[model samples]
Structure formats: C-alpha cells, structure tokens
Target: MNPVKTIQRLWLLFLLQIPFALMAQHPVRLAVAGITHGHSDWIYNRKLRGDIEIAGIYETNADRVQEFRKRYQLPENLFYTNLEQLLDKVKPEGVMAFGPVNEHIAVVRACAPRKINVMVEKPLATTYKDAQEIADLAKRYGIKVLTDFETSWYASNQYVRNSYKEGRLGQLRKVMINDGHEGPWAMNRHFVSWLTDPVKNGGGALMDFGCYGANLMTWLMEGQRPLSVTAVTHQNRPDRYPKVEDEATIILQYPEAQCVIQASWSWSFSRKDMEVYGTKGYAIAADPVKIRTRMQGASSEVSQTLEPRSAPFNDPFAVFANVIRGTLKLEPDDVYELPVNVTVVEILDAARTSAKSGKTIYLKPRPALVQAGNVGNN
Candidate 1:
C-alpha cells in the first residue's frame, strides 16, 4: 500500500474509536448495603434496567436476605452475608446505603475507609454527631456521598426551581409543604422493625416525612440553611405505633423567608402538596410529577407535567456515573452534593431538639467561606 493511503486509513480508524472510548470510560457497578428501606424498589428497578449492575447485596440477617431475594427475584449469588466480604469482593463503583437510620453511621464508616462513594437513604444519620462524623470522613477521603432525597431531583420540582430562578415567583416569602400518608400501618412490614423505634429512626413522623419538606425548602431557597426550627409531634395511634409519634408539624425559619411543613402518619388524607409564595406569583406542586404556577394578573395559570424519563435511582445513578467518569461536575450547593446532606442532617437534628423541648431551637450557622466549589468532587 502507498504510505499516504496507509496513514489516512489509520487516522480514519482513530476518529471512529472516539464514541466507543467515551461509552467505555465509566461503567457504574453498584452494590447495595442494607436493603431495609421500602424505597429499595427504586434500586431494584435500576438494576433491572441495566443502568447499574448489581455487584452484590449486604444484609446482616439470613431471613431478611432470603426475603429480599424472593421478593425482588435477586439472584442468590448476589447476596453477601457480611458487608466486609461484599465490599472486598464486589469492589463496587458505589454503594447504596438504605439501612436503618441507627445503622447508617456504621455503614458509612465502613465504606469511607475504602474510599467508596455512597448514596445513603435520608435522614442522613441517627444523630447530629454521627452525621458529622460521616461528613468528616467523606471530606477526609474525598469521596462522594449523597442522601436519597429523590423528590428534590424530580423534573417537576426542577420546573418549579427554574421558575424561582427566573423570578417568576418574584422575591420569596413563604413555602408550605404537606406530605402525609395513611400511617405506618399502611407501610410495608419491614419498616415496622426500625421506623417506629425513636432510637433507630431518630424521630417520629417529622423525621421521616418532614425531612422531605426541609430539604425542598433549602433546595429551592438556594441552600439557605434553616436558622431556627420549631416542631410538635403527637402520638395519635398509640395502639399501633406505641413508641413513636404518629403526627407532626414543623416550622422552619430562614433569614429571608419562612417555611411551614406538616407531616402526619395518621392522617386520613393522602396528599403530597407544596405551595411556594413569592411577591409576584405562587407556584404549587400538587404531586411529585406536576408543577402549576400563577402570576399576578396572569390570564391563565401555567401548568407542566413531567414526562416520565428515568426512575429515581436511574437518574441519580446516571449522574453519579458521569461524576465518576469525570464528565459531570458536581457543585457545592447542588442538592446531590455531600455537604448539603450533612446540612440536612443538622437541620433534622435541630428539628428533633425543637420537638422535644417544645420551643424553637436555633441552629449554628454554616461556614461563610465554604461555597459551591467545596463540595464532593465529581
């Protein structure tokens, strides 16, 4: 072959390889630790979709492992009796920690030393100190840690967020969120083991549901941590949840705005609604998938329904994969940012304190200098 023709053929082959190289760059391998949360369904769905390969599962109890395998149709080979064995063998790209709140710290501690990224289920930790320790370890090792606040990543919520950013709501004034379900009785039996235990679950209805409201409030308000929190929780169903409170209301005060969040485990109504009020207009997310807005003097209300794209786990998992692949950059203030999860823990802690004392509890201010660049590296 002529030298010029051969050189041209080699160049053409190199150009063709670019797309395949990008595709092979980062393939996410996920191992799930402690599948006790009911939301494990999302993770199971992701595994089925081929978005993430299920490297293994770590569960302490044999019976629970059997139940998980049977319920989710997970292969027997994927179950690891011990977490350490699972971590060492799987060497997964990341771990999904959906264990009980009391067990959260220990799981994170175990994974942190291995420099493994973790996506933990929220109420980040059982206590403020434990949460801080996890945060400190994450920082020390430079690992990406995320809490599973799936609603914050919902496209409908994104629409509302965009409206807020565009000043469609004008100056923010107040935000109200109501996320109440039937009760723990309606929840899966697995949740009963830990969720009703204040020692295990951290707090009652407020900690379980109010965290969503608090997270959304902070997320939409541009990462303004709550200045103070006041809350009241009642044991409406002492017969069912004898040890835990079944109803709760929390008020969070911010410097520029205030938010009222109500959650009830014993409520008759099934509602997940949020209304954000601003100087010029108001926006409401009637459900997790719809955003509706009304501006002053507007002839018609603006409405948007999010088209189904990826499931909750798939969306975050894809983002996490990109981060690991160095294609997506994670900002400090982003809700998925690890430090923000730490802040969420602090706010929930303050809320618990307020609920117990029956008084507004003040929170320590976040450091001024640590801005958007200081979060987990993507």
Candidate 2:
C-alpha cells in the first residue's frame, strides 16, 4: 500500500474515534442522594448508554446500601453515608433525590450551593413552602431543578400537548387526569412507610397520585394559577392507610376552563391516563402510546399509536444530563421545570385546604416568593 494513502486512512479513523472516546471518558457524573424510593433502581437497571456515570451515592440506611451493592455489584467506595462528604468528594454534575418527598428540600439546599443540578421523583416537595424554597435555591445558584414523572415521557400525552399547541384541539375547555395504582403497600415496605405518612409524603393518595394531574394541568394551563380549588378526600382503606386518605377528587376552576383530577390508591388496576376536551375537539390518552381523538369534522373518535419521544425528552436521566451539559433548554411550563412543579405543589396545598375545610379555596396570587425566584427563565 502507498504510505500516503495509509497515513490518510489512519487520520480519518482517528477523527471518527474522537466522539466515542469523549463519550467513554466524560460521561455525565451523577450522584444518588437516597436509595429507599422504589424507583431508585432505574439508574442501576437501565442499560449502559455511555452518557451517564454513577459517581457516588449517599444513603443513610446501610442495609439498603448493601442490598444495592449486592444487586448491582457496585464497588463499596461508590457509596457514602454522609451527603455533604459525598458531594464534596465526587462533585457530580447532578444529584437525583430518591428519598421521601420532604427530603427534596435538603437535597436542593446542598446541591444548589455546590452548583449541581437536581432531579427528584414526582412532586417537588411535600408542601408549597418547600417547593418555593427549592425554586429559590435553584434561581440563586443558576442550577436546573427538575421533577421526574413517568407520564411526562408518554407519547400520547406529548401528542395531545402538541396538537393543543398547534390549535388542532382548539381552546381547552376541560381536562381530566386519572393516576394511581392499587396501593403503595404492594410496593416496597420502606416506600410505603413514607408514602403513607402524612408529613413525609404529604397527604396519601392526594399527594402521591394527585400531583400528576396538578403537574399536567399546570403545564396545560401554561403555568397559570387556577381561580379556585375544591377537593374531597376519603379514607376508603382505613384499616391499611389510616393516617391519610386513600382516595381524592380535586377540582380546579379556571376562568375559561376547568379540570378534574381523580387520584386513588384503591384502584383495582394500575392506570395513568388523561382525557382532554377542547371547544372544537377532544383527545383521550389511554396509555403511554395509545390515544383516541375526535375532531369537529370527524364522524367518530379515532385511535392512534404514537411514536415515543426522542432522546433527552424520553428519559429523566437523559434530560438531566442534557440540561447540565447545556444541550437542552427547558420551557417555562415544561412538565418537569421548577416553575410548573412549584405550581403543582401550590395546587396540592390548596387541595388539602379545601378538602379539610369543605370549602372552595380561592387562590390569591402566585406567591411573591415563587415569582421572585425567576424560575421561568430557566
């Protein structure tokens, strides 16, 4: 072979290998703040994509840590019992909170100051106050704080949202979201403990599953605060979940539209679905990929199987890595954005108040704390 041709082929090969080399050498460093959350195993169970690296994990429970070590065959040096020590040592780009809902505040407080982003499961916090504080910390530190919801990545939901945004659904008149499972008891015992505790997980079904509706509605409304909130809660399973209500129905009245959220832990089957009605048409998201819709001219509802969302939007960890690496920008009312999740906590707060007082609770305004946080610009 000619030496010049050989040298040129080698140079081309080296150029093609550069991207793969960078992916292997500099995967996004991610830390786990807690391990008790049932969904915490997502990070370990996911097939390696070479885009994320588990830098460190901080869990107070040694047994849980051991269980994770044995299950995933992770090294002992990757675990830390103390949060601050882990943060200081690994200095990961982001931290995912897998503890109780109430613990989100502490995770944000620690990660924000360190200039590390955070992603927590579902509701941003147990209360509006904690949510506001997390938003404030994110704003102050210029870090991204995201809430992960399994429904957010649903292709059906995304299809509906896109159609609505494109004026195909017309003005949204009513939206109904149903989300829940049989109960937390059937899941991990540790998850059930905090999930049932009123203080740790907020109200039972209302906060656990209700947040899904609130989060989705807030996103559909473009982060607008509702006019008033009314809710009714019941302890259908008093024998099992005595400390908190097992079922809840929350109504949100807007100036031009309304929403009904049915959240229950007593469902015979697990489900996460939504029905959206507009002035000119309607769309029902029956599952992650199936949707039924009827437009004005359509004779009847039509069903469709939607394609899954593309990368960075399909996975929560992918989103965190993209945001931290400055490859993806979030919208003001993105389902996972801090502002939208903050409003979700606010709605839950009002729902709790309404349920207890048996009166409709009129929202005064978006709290000044939330407004001042500059969460939308993120």
Candidate 3:
C-alpha cells in the first residue's frame, strides 16, 4: 500500500463526508409559535413526516389548539398555551411561524432575544412597518430571519431563471403572475375570517396573494424598484367578504420590462402560477410541477417535470434544519430574506393605496434599515 496516496484519498473521503456527518449528528429543534392560519400545515405536516421534530407548539385559540392536537395527535404537554412558555421550556433551536400575517413581528420579537432563528410564512408580515422591526431585530440579535414561499421550492421558477441567465430566455419583457384560489373559506371557514379581515390579515387577496407576484418580479428584476404601480381591487363576493377586496390586479413597470400581478380569491379553483415572456423565448410555470419552454427560431420546444433543486430549496423543513447546523446561509437578497420580503410588503402597501386612490403610484426602494451587510452593492 502506498502511504502517501492512501493519505490523500482518506482526506478526500473525509472532506466529502463532512456535510452528511453534520446532518446525521443532530436534527434542528424547532417549535411552532401559532397554528391558527391554514398555512401552518407547511410546518406541522413536515413534523408528521418525521422530516423535522417540533419540540413544541403554541396557540391561544382553544378550538384551533384542540383541533391541531387531535390532528397531529400531539401530547397535551407538547402544545403550549403561551409563546414565552414554549420557548422557556423547550428552548428550541428555532421557531417557524404559522400564525396570521399580522403577528409575524410579535413572533420574531419573542424569539430574537433568545437568539433563536425564525422563518415565517410568506409576505413577511401584514405591513412594511412590521418587516422593518423584523430586520432590526435580526441585525441586533444576529440571527437568521427567513420568509418561506412555496414558489421558492418550485423547479419551474428556477428553470426560467436559469434560462434567462444562460441567454436562452432572451431579453426579459413582461411577467404575468396569477396566484390565489376560490377563497380561504373554501379551505377552512374558521381561518377564513381572519384571512378576510382587513385588520387581521391586511387586505384580503391583495395582501394574501399579491406578495407572491411582487416577490417573483423583484427576484426576476434582480431587485430593481418599479417606476410606478397601478392597481384595481374589488370584492366579487362582497356578501361573503364585505370587509376586504377579494381580487386585485397590479401592474409594476420597470425600465426594460413590466409585470402583471393578478391576485384573486375568486378563482374557480386554487392557483398560484406564472408566465414569463421574453423577446426570444417564453416560459410557463404551470403550478410547481410543470414547465414548458419555447425558443424563437428553434426547431422544437422543451418541457420538464421539474424536481426540486436540493435541500433547503427543496422545502422549509430541509432549509431550516441545515440553517440550524450552520450549513446553509440565507442571502440578504434571497426571496426568503428580510430585505426581499420588505420590498414585498412595500409593493403590497402601494397596491392597496393604488386600489383605494384609483390611480397609479410611484415606488422607490426604501434604504434598508440594516443595510450594513446587504449583498448586491453593500
């Protein structure tokens, strides 16, 4: 046996095994802060799959707490009635929020001082003000704050990005995004009330689904601010959702391109899909599972049933687990990052204002509060 060659080979093997070793050694300890929103399924279901172990869960709604307890078969003690109590007892490594869009800040505030990382369902919060607080706390505590989106896990979206970068998708022109469903009520009536309330959930479909289009367009534009935003919103089902608009159409104008964000709660069925049109080609992300691409003057087209990119990008559970072990770092500009979500909220705010004013509104990127480490130009 050659000692020198054997030593080099052994070192290579060890280097290759490092990541797997770290992954197997310990799983991330997580706790859920709220289970009221229907989106909580994103977190709790993962626990059911044994994908992630939630050390604790919390909710003040007795009915919801009992319902989730019955569904998950969680022990009485595994569910806490208070946020601080859950954190104090379990001392989990991180917390994943599944509460109302409005409570994102309170959840982060509770977890920040403890140095626990947090990931909330998309939009970051109900307003830009809350997002600002989230960023400040993240900077002060030096903990990761993530906003997860089901779009971030789609291969079709990634394929479009890859094509554009490779010069195959051609010069970007317009992005059309339609995201929503028949309504939150079609999913769960109890959750629908807060979801439809302007105060608790912001502004119906515009608030709930508008963030998706904004986040996608922001990422597609490489964080460019829109010249102006024009929007119209209305309640197609005012009898059912009198407090908020159930549908909205927002147009965002960029220097070289434009985007149409169609967010609605009045669709015949559930939807969260997009289409990208460029001078030389076009791509359609039909739901998350399918993608079709056509190139100008090409002999044929390409289609894909895209698989998830990898861990972290694959799902929220995978991402947070790696984050806890210090393996994955969230980019400041990443869709899940604070700055990106702030822009999302900002756009939603403008959309709402535009809807109410019945006019176009200009948008400027607000200088990030914690801009010290912003990635693109910092």
Candidate 4:
C-alpha cells in the first residue's frame, strides 16, 4: 500500500477502536453484599451501562446463589458465600448491601475496615442503634456510607427540591408524602421472609415505606431533627402480615413546618408521591418525572414533565460511581447522605415508639442530637 493510504487506514482503525476503548474504561467496580433483598433485582435488572460493573456478589444462601446465577446467567466464579472472601478476591471499590436492613451493619463493618465505601438501601438500618454504629464506623474509617432511595433519583423530587432551595416555593409550611403498595407478601420467599420480620426489617410499612418520607423530610429540613413524632399503625392483614403492621401514618412536627407521612401496604395501588406546600406556592411530585405546581396568585395549577436528570443524579449507581470517583460531592443533607438517612432512621424509630405507645415522642434539640450522629457535616 502507498504511505498515504497506509496512514489513512491507520486513522480509520483508530476511530473504529475508540468506542471499544471507551466502553471498557473506568467502570466502577462494585460488590453486592447480599442478594436476598427484593430490591437486589435493581443490580441485575438495570440495563447494561458502561459506568458500573459488578465485581463480585456474596450471598449466604447457596440456594439463592444458584437461583440468581441461573436467572441472570451470572458467572459461577462471581458468587461467594463469604462476604469478606468476596471482597478480598474482587477488591471492589464499594459494597452495595442487598441484605436485610439489620444486616447493613455487617456489610459496613466488613467494608469499613478495608477502607471501602458502602451504600445501603433506604432507612440505613433496621434500628437507630445500627444506624449510629454504621455512621461511627464510616467516620472512623474515613469512608463514605450512603443510603440509597429510589426517590433520590426522581427528577420531580429534584425539581421540587431545587424549587424550594431557590425560593420558588417560598418558606416551608407542610409536606405530605405518600408511599408503598399492597404489601410484599406476594414477593419471593427470600424477600418476604425478612421484609415482614420485626427484627430483620425493623417494622412493616412503618419501616419499609415510612423511611421514604422521613428521608425526604430530613433532607428538606436540612438535617434538622423533628421537634416531635406522632404515629399510628394498624395490622390490616393478619393472615398475610401476621408479624407486622400493614399500615402506618406518621406526623413529623418541625419548628415552622409539619410533614405527614402515609406509608401503607394496604394501598389500592402503588405510589411514591409527595406534596410540598410553602407560603407562596406548592409543588406536587406526581411521580418520578411529573410535577404539578401552583404559584402564588396563579389561577390554575400547571403540570410539567421533566427530562431525565443528568449523570450522577439520574440513578443510584450513577451517584455512587461519581461520588467514589470524586466527580460528585454530596451536600450536607443531600437525600442520599448518611446524616439525612440517620435522621430518617431516627424518625422511623420514633414513629415506631409513638405508634406503640399511642403518644407523640419529643426529640432533643439539633445540637444535642448531632453529637450522637444526628446530623451530617455542613
């Protein structure tokens, strides 16, 4: 071939190889701590993306491992019965817990000493004690511990949050958050077993879906602990959820705002929507991507559809990847931050207590509670 033709051929080859090179570059190496949680499907079911790669998975149940492997066609070598061994083998950059809520502490305990960050599904822990321990461990090890919520990735929620922060919503007044569906009893046995267990899941809808509202409210309050928590719970389906309540309603009172959280497994249909009312206007996150709003003096409410969020905000794994790679920095009370989730766990804990006692529970002042892992760093 002529020299000019040879050079042209080389340039064409380089262009052809660019996409392959980019596809294989800088994918976040992540480990799954457990695969029993119902939400564990999030990892396996997500559309393939170049930004995240599952390095290893640890599940104590051999049957579950086999089932998942067959279902997802995952490699045999990628499965491990021991978490620590899985971590040592793959050396993942972070661990995402797909275990029972109480088991989050174990995941963090193992990863923290290794200086590996962790992200757990919502509520952080089954109890406040575990949440505090996880927080302390992360602080001591200088690793990031995040709690992931599906709502955190919602464009509508982000839009509402931005509107509030930018003063479009004006001073906060009340927020109403509705969450949950018609129970998890119909889910797989592995998921249903732990999810309805009092110890494994903390509580029923109060701990399962209640955390969403608590997490959002804490973030909206900028990590402020609620002044008081009042709650009522009902066990509507004794045949299905024999051990836990199927319905919960919680009231969070702030100095100048109040939030009503309706979390139920008895809803006629699934929903995860919230309404934020301020002095000047109100915004309703109708769903993940739709927002209904009414501004001060506006005659009619307006509904707007939002585009998908940009990278690092569009999905939980994206956020985790960006944070681990130092491309994203979490604000003090960003919905996913540890402190906000800690407060969320606190609120859930209080809600459980109030429901049990049929009395409102008063909380300590913000400063006093901060010492005990109540707030995130500003």
Pairwise TM-score winner, candidates 2 and 3: 2
RMSD of 2: 3.3
Report the lDDT tens digits of candidate 2 across residue range 242-351: 89999999999999999999999999999999999998899999999999999989999899898888887788898888878877887767898987899899999999
Write the candidate numbers in order of decreasing TM-score. 2, 4, 1, 3
Q: For residues 72-167, write the lDDT of model 1, one tens digit per residue.
A: 787888988788889998899788887788887877788888988888787678787887777777777777777777675566666677788998
Q: Tens digits of per-residue lDDT for model 3 on 114-139?
A: 98889888778888788888888888
Per-model TM-score on C-alpha atoms? 0.90, 0.93, 0.89, 0.90
Q: Evaluate model 2: give its lDDT.
A: 0.90
lDDT of 4 by residue, 1-378 (tens): 799999999999999999977754769899999899888888878768888989999998888888899999999999888899988889999999988999999999999989898999877998888887887887777788889988988999988988999999999999999998978988989989989999999999999999999999888888788899999999999899999999999999998999999999998899999999999999999999999999998999999999978876877988888888777888867888887887899899999999999999998754333332433222
Candidate that scores best on lDDT: 2
Top-TM-score structure, candidate number: 2
Q: lDDT per model, in order?
A: 0.78, 0.90, 0.82, 0.88
Give candidate 1's whole-model lDDT: 0.78
| Clash count for each candidate, listed in order shown | 0, 0, 0, 0
Error of 4 at 328 (Å): 1.4
